[model samples]
Target: MLTAERKRKLLEVLQSEGKILASELSRRFGVSEDTVRRDLRELDRAGFLQRVHGGALPRTPTSVEHKARQKESTDAKKRIGAAAAQLLRQGQLVALDAGTTPLAVLDRLAPDLSLTIVTHSLPAATVLAEHPRIEVVVIGGRLFKSARAGVGVATVDAYRLLRPDLCILGAAGLHPEAGVTTFDSEEAEVKRAMIAHAARVAVVVASEKLGTVAPHLITPAGRLTHLITDSAAADDLLAPYREMGVEVVAV
Candidate 1:
């Protein structure tokens, strides 16, 4: 078959399968593994798929800046955020992670709800401060402009100091295999600290991020106590998490 036609068929297979292995593609397309690798490399360079260790997975938009991502995911964020709020308890010390979806939790909280919240996200702290009954603890560090969050040693260290009753985590990617991932190493460190110190951790993410893998990992998917997402995510997309013993809440 022609190279162009083979590449087209490769993408079609990738779309339907959600992942691709070079050896399998080589067998299917009647090409050598090296040719399959080259095709995947070109496709990765074109921003169509993200190359992984042995194959490629769908690319996630977690690299997009916080503001631009806000322009997307309108209703899904609201529904997921509201469902996350239901998981909260009064007078709890909450660790809020940095991301649009995690930050959305503040919007759904009752005005009179009493809680203490800690965060490394400048944007998240800004919103939590508006709640008079909620005490806000800001973790200081270098600002990560893309996600409007703080990153660095201080942010990681502060999270180690206290055990939050619950943590509202966020992810750039949430694959059943790759687990909870983000785009930045420092951000992953900060999130890891939160996971280690929180009594229970809940991730609030959009449906589109399911089955996708990001570059850096915060924790394995099994580490999460709760996986909350929009109902647009299919049952099959969420079954692995449930099998991992996580409480899956699809809003």
Candidate 2:
């Protein structure tokens, strides 16, 4: 078949499967593995797909800025947040990570429920200030402009001082193999520290982030006590996490 024809069919297969392996594509297209690799490279360069090890996944936006993220999935975030809030207990100390979804959790908290909250998110802390019954601890450090959160040596150091009962974590990617990942190194460090300081960790994510990946690695799915996401997430994508002992809650 012609190269153009092969590439077009490759994209159709990728769209149907969400991801494609090079060897499989080569077999299906009656081409060499080298030709399949070149096709994937070209597709990735054109911003049509994301090349991964041995495969390619559909291209997804990696916007870190708050305003850009705010435009993506508000209702899903609300459902995920409200579902996460139901896990909270009065008087338990909770640590919240910095992300639009984690901020959603703070927005859904019961007005009268009392709990001590620690966070690096400016918006989350600001909202929590109105809840007089809940003591707010803001970690001070260099601001990560993209996500509008604090992340630095100071933030990690502060986290070492207290152990939170639960941590509402965020992720740039949540893959079973790649584990939990974020886009920035410092932000990953802060999240790692939060996980270390918390007795239980709950990763709250929107449906679109499922099966996605990012640059920096946090802990694996096995370390999580709970996985909170919207109902739109595919069961096939979440199955690995459930098998790994994570309590998967789809709201």
Error of 2 at 53 (Å): 2.8
Which 10-residue span in candidate 1 carries the lowest summed lDDT? 55-64
lDDT of 1 by residue, 51-150 (tens): 8878888877655688888877879999999999998888899999988898888898988888888988898888887787888989888988998988
The alpha-carbon deviation from the true structure for residue 213 of candidate 2, after best TM-score superposition, in angstroms, is 1.9
Give the clashing residue pairs of candidate 1, or none: none
For every model in order, what is the number of clashing pairs?
0, 0
Candidate 1 deviant stretches above 4 angstroms: none
Residue 22's lDDT in candidate 2: 96
lDDT of 2 by residue, 92-172 (tens): 999999888999987777888998999999999999988868989899899888888898999988987878899999998
Error of 2 at 233 (Å): 2.0
**lDDT score of residue 14 within candidate 2:** 79
Q: How high is the CA lDDT of each candidate model? A: 0.88, 0.86
